[model samples]
Target: MTPDEFTATYREHYPRLVNLARRIVGDQATAEDVAQDAFVALLKATLHDEQTVPRFLSVAVKNRSRDVLRHRKVAHKYAPFETFGPLSAEYALSVALFIDIIAALRTLPASQRRAIVLRTYAGLSEAEIADRMGWARGTVKSHTARARASLRRELAEVA
Candidate 1:
């Protein structure tokens, strides 16, 4: 594709691709980075068909998200002990609570987790989440509602 075509494609698809990556990776900043990287990779390649651009970008974003998740897993394995250094009692308690919430999020089923993350962290509306996840709008709402209830119960028990 030419530079203009590439620019147009990027503008059209960037937001949706970033949302897709965010669903996979669950972090907005990292998702943006992943989407940008995919576009950069597309620019570097020679492609004869503009029609394939969206599919190519979607696959690229998924691969990059997987790479990021793998790297995070490896990093967590060797994370430094001082990462959570001495803190005030209130600060420590808050940190513990945050950790607990993350753990609770992980325990949810994959659909529930993705729905909750997309809705809460990415701030996507139900219709947007439905489009990204290829689910009906009502399905997204149901998943999010169930996930929220489960989290509430789990956190309440912990408290």
Candidate 2:
């Protein structure tokens, strides 16, 4: 894509892509960085189809988000050394739970994922999520409820 096309695509998909990354990595700043890096990578890539740009960006964001999560897991696994102590069982359990939550979040549909992530992770109210996602308040509620139910099912074994 040309620079102009890339700019337009970035403007259109950036928020959703960032949201996607946030769902996986669970950090707003890191999500934004992942999205930005995906755009940068897109700019460097050669694609014959403009329609595939969004897909490309989404895949790139997901892969990069997983990388962030992996690196975080590794850092947390070894964090006790920096603190001059051994890793606590509680800390290890929390890390595993976090990883499970992210995996469960990924299994949700897009609307449900957006709703729950905004509500739980980003700490947005239902109205705010509706406004950001361009859905009705009721729709947001429904999505959030269903998403929560699905997450509960997916993570029940963990608990």
Task: Judging by TM-score against the true structure, name the best candidate.
Answer: 1
Candidate with maximal lDDT: 1
Output the lDDT of residue 92, model 2: 86
How far residue 29's Cα lies from its native spot in candidate 2, in Å, is 0.3
Per model, how many backbone clashes are there?
A: 0, 0
Question: Model 1, which residues run further than 4 Å from truth?
Answer: 84-159
User: Per-residue CA lDDT of candidate 2, range 34-120, in tens?
Assistant: 999999989889898888988999999999999999998888888866565677899989989999999999999988998999999
